[model samples]
Target: MSNGVSTSTDKIIVDRSRSHRNKAVSKAVRQTRERLQTGHVGNFDRELIAMHISAMLQGASIMPVFVVIIAGLGIYFTRDIQIFTWAFLTLSAHAINMLLAKRAAKQEITSESARKWRRILILGQVLIGCCWAFFAIQGCATCEGQSFAAYKGAMLLAAVCVTAMSNFMLPRAVLFSFAPTVLALCFRVALTREPLDLGLMAIFVTAVVFFTFITDRLFQSNLKILSFQSEKDDLIVELEVAKSMSDEARRRAEEANLAKSRFLASMSHELRTPLNAILGFSEVMSAEVMGPLNNPTYKEYTGDIHRSGQHLLNLINEILDLSRIEAGKYDLSEEAISLLDIAEDCIGMVQLRARAKNISISQQFEPKLPSLWADEKSLRQVVLNLLSNAVKFTPQGGEICVKVGWTAGGGQYVSIKDNGPGIPEEEIPVVLSAFGQGSIAIKSAEQGTGLGLPIVQAILAKHDGQFILKSKLREGTEAIAILPAMRVLQSLPAVEDALTVGRKRKSFA
Candidate 1:
């Protein structure tokens, strides 16, 4: 029975040994094949890989000291000289590799340099793997019972920690460093010829396979993070370039607009001089003040000439006004003035033209509306323009309503509404632009230069007031100009403290 048990035990050891050997060989083959299939590291990714390796090396530098301490303890407890020697050699080799890796990290890693350093670090990892294998083999060789279990546990724990530490670095380096040590451990345990040791060896082999899988996943994750960072940096650079181009284009546009304004300003005096002379001469000829024309055709021709000259002069004046307003050159002469008085005067001026078209004018003036601190000339012009537009657009017998009152917010407002074919809502912006007549205004017999509303808006802006135009198709159009409350003059309290003083002075006199 004893001889039979010995034979069975020996057979089990041989079978386990063979199984473990096959596993190690197959694992190595699979790793080699996978590595070859993966091809070379990308040129762009090489530096990142080097950086990762350098970081792992720096962190792993301290790991050797722990191994030395653990191995020294194992030697003290078991009195094993080989274990101490292996520990010392591993510490020395790891320290040297750490110094070299740190030096390499400081250098700028180009593609060529990265490849060279990768190979050197991998070779160092292989040497460290050999040292660990030696410790595991020699430490467990002479150990027995509880000492054997403790030493095996400590060495396995160290191997797992080392594998985990290297997971962030190149997978090839991790495989080269950890696989050999783990395989040697499995082989050593399989030689014990005991069922318990063989089972433990199987567990170790399985752990190594699982660890390699985890390391591969970690390596792939690091590559993904690096790739995303590179893409983000590239997008940021592109956005900066686009923003710079947009700024340059905007600067050029502003310069061109400034040049155009300057040109218009410089030519204003020259253009108006000839226009004024033409109007003066045409007016004299049309009125026959110089002399009576003998030909009736000449009289009619002078009338046409006078009207054309007047129209041209008005257009030029409107252009110059708008240009000066845009150039910030229109100065206001402000005074305390009554808005009601100005509205009345403007209505009176346009009443003749309105009556000629049979358009009835109506007024709604707020009783005792406050006076405005404003530019009188500009205010008068604003009112006149609104009144003229209302009269011109209104058909025969159409009614025009002009109102001067306080705004809801306590400001003064002048509103003019005309019962005419109202401007289309979409064309309101066009009519408010310089020389941008609406389709309705262009079709009407009273076509204007289209500068009226823009001028009103500009003048109101200068006064810190607001101009609002509201109209609907086929309904009447209303234009409102509001002066802010700050511009509305308020009267002082009359004789609150001075009433008694005035009465006493009267009695004394």
Candidate 2:
């Protein structure tokens, strides 16, 4: 049996314990949420900017194509050569925006750098807006009537909507992108002041306001999505760390327990040899086998030595038995055994002690019980432990009832109950644990190593059985050992029936 601490002390070993790591991750996520709820979105500005830039670039590939198509329509309707110049300038502005977006995507955008990039992208949008402004002011002079004015207003509205949808990630980028065109429309409307021109101006202003509101909403939604995803990732990492730490702790505990058991089990021989010598010498001296001791004090001392040595030997034996059971090395030499007879024998063994304590031992055995297919020695030990505990705990002149009977499942049970001070409800588990003594047991004059019940439990478990200890304060305690039904060995067929079966087999042959 080895005794050593199992905790690792190496500096390089990272303690990825779950509880601490989870707390840290939870704190970080909570802080992030607090910042967001407090209107402190600066921390996440970089992510917002990156999303805006990516969306702009994704749709950039088709913007120039859209510009060329619009320019072609304008040239056909107005018969104007200047539309070609407008298309070239608009495409140039779009190209510059795309280049800036690509450059922003390649850099590690921090919150501080995001503001600088925001301004640069807004400038690119303004340049595009100026091109649109020039187109809005051209007036389609070759086309006649209010129909031509409505066509120009519809085109400007489409341009505003497209800008709002594409640049929604960046704050104010959509508004600035079309502000120049709105100004140009106002200028054109003041010069003419026709009802149709006024209506076009009013419609264009409403479209800009509506689209800008929609853009801001989309930006908030995307920000929330990114926050939720980040939180989920952190939780997964924390849970994994916790699981690994729990597994490592469990493994270390098991290893330490096994080592302790091995150490105690290994000392059986070394311990018993000295105990045997002490018992033998003390017994001889107390009995005056070699010679009579003239001194009365020496005679009394010899007896004390013998008794103490016997107690020590018993304690060591119990420890070894429990250790062997824990180490999974306690083999059972099984046989056809009578539980009733074993219970009777154990009662007899404890009868002397019970009598010395002025306790009454009573037996209630069910007659004609079948033998059990179990280890006789183990059953005997289990019975002895229960009976001895009853005698030890029972008050003087108290009743100790021992019952052996068939179980409802056709198995068997031995119950030993004593009218003594019962164990506390909370202390029941404590007493069942190895080497654990309850409050009552600890204060009793008849103290033990507290291995008796645990050993009985282990033995019954090895026989595929259960040991139940039920107790309530001042109500006395009962220990019951129950063997499963499968271990009950029923009687075989009578000789005549066996002979008949054998004759049938021969006839078939």
Best by lDDT: 2
For candidate 1, what is the lDDT?
Answer: 0.75
Off by over 4 Å in 1: 1-47, 53-61, 64-82, 99-108, 111-177, 188-255, 403-410, 423-428, 495-509
Q: List the candidate 2 regions with Cα displacement exceeding 4 Å.
A: 1-42, 51-59, 65-87, 129-168, 179-262, 291-300, 328-342, 361-376, 401-415, 454-468, 480-509
Residue-level lDDT of model 2, residues 265-305, one tens digit each, is 67777888888999999988988999999999999998899
Error of 2 at 501 (Å): 5.4
Can you write out model 1's per-residue Cα lDDT over 171-218, one digit (the tens) per residue? 666667766777776787767666655655666667667776777787
Instruction: Quote each prediction's TM-score.
Output: 0.71, 0.72
